[model samples]
Target: MSFCSFFGGEVYKDHFKPGVYVCSKCDHQLFTSRSKYEHSSPWPAFTETIREDSVSKHQERPGAFKVQCGKCGNGLGHEFVNDGPARGSSRF
Candidate 1:
């Protein structure tokens, strides 16, 4: 399945609760989320992700972010601005 089926939102760039964005492409799960003051990047952006082989970046005209899922390949948006100056991370 694709992310659009699970978390399909016209504009996922919107701020959301804190959590991790599982890879609909790889079923890779980890810690991440959209903080209250996170950057709203158009692509799926996770302030934090699995430090190991859990996530992997793909190739594109610009580029697309994909999560490593155990089941299948999942698209977890792209990496945007993290509240490093603040706290928590945002997934868009």
Candidate 2:
């Protein structure tokens, strides 16, 4: 599968330069390049957020959380614990 299907962006197996990333649906700044990191998974990963309220998390299923755009409530991805390159939890 293409990585774009996961994050709505062409997946490059490299870190993105420091910049702003917005929600595809609402154009709200949901993540910053500084927070992004390369993961072995299909989609990119983020270790942190630019702001505390940049995104919203919802429990999609048991033991899994669905991340969404805070402004427009567009589904972004899922949150996984201990699934990052540095052993940090990440948003996939």
Candidate 3:
């Protein structure tokens, strides 16, 4: 299946309703749509995760982080510190 089939329409342009979002391949619950927010970026954004271990984070470099599905290792997106809706905050 394509990435958008599980994630939604286009990344940032798609507005997901409040619900639970899971991995398309494994059905592992990854995020809740309620946490989804609009940041004017080119992908869907979330304020937080449904659980502490629902997702995984990888540090690509000294200060860069890549967020992905914990169960299937699907590339969800990235996390940026102090670059969200609020200053000095983080979003995925």
Best by lDDT: 3
* Per-residue alpha-carbon lDDT of candidate 3 for residues 10-92, written as tens digits (9 for 90 to 100): 64337566677776667778767777777677666777777878779988865458988788888777777666677666787
Give the alpha carbon lDDT tens digit for every residue of 1-92 in model 1. Answer: 12322444544345365555555555456445532233443443344544555555554333334444434545444443343334444343
Q: What TM-score against the true fold does each predicted structure earn?
A: 0.41, 0.74, 0.75
Top TM-score prediction, candidate number:
3
From the highest lDDT down, the ranking of the candidates is 3, 2, 1
- The local distance difference test score of each candidate is 0.43, 0.66, 0.69
Q: Model 3: how large is the Cα RMSD against the reference?
A: 3.5
Better of 1 and 3 by TM-score: 3
lDDT of 2: 0.66
Backbone clash pairs for candidate 2 read: none
